[model samples]
Target chain A: MTTYFNEMYDSGKVRPPYARLEDWTRSMPAELREMKQAEAEALFRRIGITFAVYGEGGDPDRLIPFDMFPRVFTSGEWARLERGIKQRARALNAFLVDVYGRGEIVRAGRIPGRLVYRNAAYEKAVVGFVPSKGVYSHVVGIDLVRTGADEFFVLEDNCRTPSGVSYMLENREIMMRMFPDLFRGNRIEPVDSYPEKLRRTLASVAPTKCERDPTIVILTPGHFNSAYYEHSFLADLMGVELVEGADLFVEGEYVFMRTTEGPKRVDVIYRRVDDDYIDPLCFRPDSMLGIPGLMDVYRSGGVSICSAPGAGVADDKAVYTYVPEMIRFYLGEEPLLKNVPTWQCSKTDDCKYVLENLHELVVKEVHGSGGYGMLVGPKSTKAEIEAYRARVEADPGNYIAQPTLALSTTPTFVDEGIAPRHVDLRPYCLVGERVELVPGGLTRVALTEGSLVVNSSQGGGVKDTWVLAE
Target chain B: MILTVDHVTLYRYDRPVRGLVQSHRLMPSTCTGQRVLNWAVTVTDGLAGGAFRDGAGDWIQGWSVPGPVSEVAVTVRGTVETTDQAGVLRGHRELTPPDCYLQSTPSTRSDLALAELAATVAGHDDVLDAAHRLSGLVSEAIVYTPGATAATTTASEALALGKGVCQDHSHALLAVARQAGLPARYVSGYLLVEGDGAAEGQEAAHAWAEIWVRGLGWVGFDPANRCCPDDRYIRLGSGLDAQDAAPIRGTARGTGFEKLDVTVAVQAVQQ
Candidate 1:
């Protein structure tokens, strides 16, 4: 068994960044701790923040469990991470523009042509047309995992409308409401300006056709979507209209939102809908959720779309391995973050090794999300491993395997008392005219014992992440 | 050769619609093979919205009609000068890689029959020769029979029926070419069928297949005619399938049953 790195404690001593947390936890009795946990859940429910898990027949509006223990990172530590995150965001945007325009990276022979052009996410419609400010993926969510004291590895990149930002702000709000004294003692940076920054970032990329103040709106798939709460919350915070596909129409040259007074032209749309359902004329003809002739207007510079269509191409699982190479080629700088060593089963040698080491690796599908259709080697039963091996063998190109990472852990309030649980972080990096990232991000902790997966759909709980001020 | 085209499409709805939006790829392509002397596309009571050149080098134009109307008419008239260099598309600028066309859409997906048809081209080491053989096989497999297949018919279905129109023939050729590891796409354009060419479906608006040859770029092949596209072929646009490469795509808001009528005329003009 491998020993895990504890964030709060270092070889039986408290780490400097979490020194104050020790006294706060010890001073609170078990009853108060239990009461606080209950209070956090009530607060979350009162605010009507619920995450709907896909494929699970439980409560559709179930509240994601919240942990009271805050994940802390020192100012010095965050400075490096912020730089790395912003750099990665810039590189990702550069890669998107490159792939859609000339595919210079592919011609350079750094990445294979099949991976970029033949991927399902690559949109042929948006080729040769560049969005305003040359930015695709306006909001880049980079999932990061910590191993040793200073080793952080990127698990994946979410380029197309990554959800859970509402949780980030809500967690901080609930924490400040419950522990006012903790905020006074620690000089933690506030993430309240995130919405304002996001609004400005979006407005900065308004279409050139707009002569006056550009009107921005959030296009949602409606209240039935899993991330509906986040869409409405962000719209409310940003002071923008939240409209559905029916509320918007393609008229003349631009998209317009139907209002009580009259029709209003929308300049920029922060769409939460996927590429396939954004425009019926350009993509899936059967999609009722898309505006007709929207792609024509977009290509002609009549409007701007946040996280431009075809941005998903850069965030594909098979394409993730080339991100570091993209950073070097596009920015002419070394990558600040490290990518986990991955074995693509598409290769002959890699497939053979993955098949042999089925019990020592983690395998995931190329296009799957939400932690579905994956195999955890050490945690799975022998029958499950064998079953997954057959699936991998059936389609080698669709599977990729990675070694089981020893994820770091943080102290958590459990039924038996405070114990260590695995955790991960996802920071939402905003890219527009300028690259920006709030000091703090959402920290997800595995409530179950010894679990490395931190996806909310997979029995994971969230906590408030704090970045100290120098 | 100078070819003139007159194309008109009429759409009638049982009930009035709130609005209608349309995207058109009707303009002749710009390349060494074809030169547009004059062209115009008009819609009844419609406003020209936006226009741009796409990655596939097709000029796409948008139009919208605020409707409470029962009928809409779209008209296109153009004159183009053509000189085909043996069906090779030369001096055409496009950003999308050939690898993108290798992807199979619903109409071009290969079945077991298509895979077996592709196997006949095995051991033909020359890429251009292999492409020609695949085109010939598709021609021999599906006989040209007008009204035999609908617009939604897939390549395999057409082959199984052994009878189809130009669209089915192109789709079948695309499927077999892709199955043989050659990238292919559907090309929509005007074909001036006269005399001997009339047996080649005699359709003014024609569809064919273009396979990518390593040294020659994109080469056009009309499996329905069992011949390569020449000066009589005026290329408009290309896509993964017929629906994607359609000259006009439109949607009208309202619960109205729609009826479509189209007429196209292509003639050789005195140079």
Candidate 2:
């Protein structure tokens, strides 16, 4: 019988940011709204914005269900969020440098040495090497969820090539074209400059090997990857070439891309391929998706890799708990954003508490994503809880438990008129010479009733998020 | 003692590949007991890519050959002065923590055979004693036999078979030492083995295990020789296993089978 806060309504009054949307929802007819939804689907299909899900039947290109209604955020709320995100981004980059250089944080006794030194994500090859511009995660996506107007918690940190900005930009593009009237009186912030800003951010971190303007290219694992659309989309928008491994080669410590004119030296690569598959000579030798001798050129400072290799160590779920301490230890300031209270099952006491209270807590794998390999406690049956408890007991370090919060909801046009669906926000923050972010981000909603998981891989949909100007 | 080394490795392909990329770890040791004098690593028909000194105190260089070529030769010629410190390696510029070496790789993962070998040192009072004891156990368990195992064989497989080359000996030592809670790694290097009846005779190349001692830093032990690495040993590099610490790792484009032919000569100079 727990109550969830409605973003549009409180005490029978419409929220200020959502006041205009409330009247629009009441005035619009059901048939017209349904027609608009179909039109939105057609636009998205024509644009070829489909996410390929692995191991699925029929077609792999499943359209990420897009909702017609837009989620609204006020200027004041976004301003605070922007500041917090920048602070978090700065702290994340500083942690990466410190861990790879002097081991200051581990020596200070703030974090356990075993957790970092023994982590699978910790790359020993890049030890004692500082990347160009001292930035590790040039782009970070902080997935956040809200419980109330003043209560927000960061659910996850995507530090390594977070892949949803293209969707964020496309959502706004379709929204503006579909409903020009909605933006007439509402001074909404524009996010169309994200591609240009991203290009600038990448160019600022070019390696010292660059003589003239740095030649930047987006390295993709190829069309078979699930995020191929985002890779080609961003490359096209940024006016950069989308290349595979065969298109590039290493010659005398520098990378060169093959062209009809001739071989051109590439100074910067915003690669979407994983670290294990980025270099065949240094990493997995059998990998076909990686360029040979790429790591050697990278380590010698001939080229720059955006969101540098080994950046995933910070995004690990176990490392996520120490971010507040990182903010304090590195930035010398308190965290503006909040973290969800997490019970690390690695600790004996926490494991015991999680075992005893299995039915009320949400359990997630330390390295799992896309709504896979997790247990949402309240909705799970007793048999399911017992089965999950055994897994937690077997390997406590691999699991973390959290108390399920009543996630906030927004009204949506469903088959039976306006209904509420759970929602979460993922704001992409760009870090480079300057830490900045586009005002709004990708807002994902769970289409199932009373479902809190909003991952696109699951039965979730995306909505256009709008931030009003002051 | 000053040791002079002239090593050459050739990778011959049945058909010429489109491209040949290589990363070479054929640099001389720069530790306290060893000092390099006029060391040079050259490649035939290959463009020098990039070079950097790794945290493990080894200089790695990259090379790529634009081909339709048949053979690639990697030549290493160096002179290194060494002193016997009872297997204690000093002045190595390694930045990784000792505990990080405790992490087991697929090639060094301990199975029941390795577990049994590790159990011989159970209830041993001292860690250094246990490390030496485990090394001695691995040497006794697996005799030096040429071609009994492949280069990629796991330590457990070698122990079960009870006979292997120096590569298997190093892997077995790594597996048992890690099981006994001692941080250990595989060391790829060259040893001065003169005369006939050499161990495995893998073209004068040798592999050993280095374990972290409490009071001492890192100490190298050659289980194949049943002794510690002396002034005759020249440490090239170290990693979690044989493949990771390979002196030469590379990939060639196009479909072609590769045949490796290597010859190494390590001689002591009267200095």
On residues A1-470, what C-alpha lDDT tens digit does candidate 1 reach at each position?
89999999999999999999999998999999989999999999999999999988799989999999999999989999999999999999999999999999999999999999999999999999899999999999999999988999999999999999999999999999999999999999999999999999999999979887889999999999999999999999999999988888888888889999899999999999999999888999999888888899989999999989999999999999999999999999999999999999999999999999989999999998878999989999999999999999999999998999999999998889999999999999999899999999999999999898888999899999999999
lDDT of 2 by residue, B123-216 (tens): 8878888888898999899988888899778888899899998999999999998888888999999889865535336446888999999888
User: How displaced is residue B130 in candidate 2, in Å?
Assistant: 1.6
- Scored by lDDT, model 1 comes in at 0.93
* Candidate 1 Cα outliers beyond 4 Å, as residue runs: B196-201
- Chain B only: TM-score of model 2: 0.95
**How big an interface RMSD has model 2?**
1.0
Docking class of 2: medium
